[model samples]
Target: SADYQKILKDGGFVISMSGKGNCYDNAMVETVFKTLKAEIIWRTIFLSRLEAEIAIGRYIDGFYNPVRRHSALGYRSPCDFEAAA
Candidate 1:
């Protein structure tokens, strides 16, 4: 624990932690990973790491962030929500 704290302090990184035994703090990230796996990862077989990287980058940039609607953001895509903000 001290090592982790020291490393964060040295790196000037802010640590965000959930309360002990509370999983809700990471729910949003977990949901995104689950969606990615279901929608993109599970559907394709990558021939190379580079291809996978590019495909994933395209999926996130061309589709997910700009096109996919998120119910948590009142059914708006992230780009829409950000522009509105």
Candidate 2:
């Protein structure tokens, strides 16, 4: 929409949209969401919105970024990959 484009432009942000039916355009993000759903969201029950937010934050910061191995990074965690780079 023109409004959305205007908002993005006004905010000094670049907008990139995938074409309709283009699964490969956002494959990495889709994979991450799928993994998060399977590994964390599906396994835990949250009592409140805050609890869920904290849990997801911990999962990404404490485990995923620092400890979890990723196949794309030669089985290294993101932190390790960054360190090597």
Model 1, 56-81: lDDT tens digits are 99999999999999999999999999
The TM-score between candidate 1 and the true structure equals 0.81
Report lDDT (CA) for all predictions.
0.95, 0.95
lDDT accuracy of residue 39 in candidate 1: 95
- Candidate 2 local lDDT, 1-85, one digit each (tens): 9998999999999899978999998998998899899999999999999999999999999998999999999999999999999
| Candidate 1 ranges with C-alpha deviation above 4 Å | 1-13, 19-22
List per-candidate RMSD values in Å: 2.2, 1.7
Give the per-residue Cα lDDT of candidate 1 at 21. 81
lDDT, candidate 1, at 68: 100
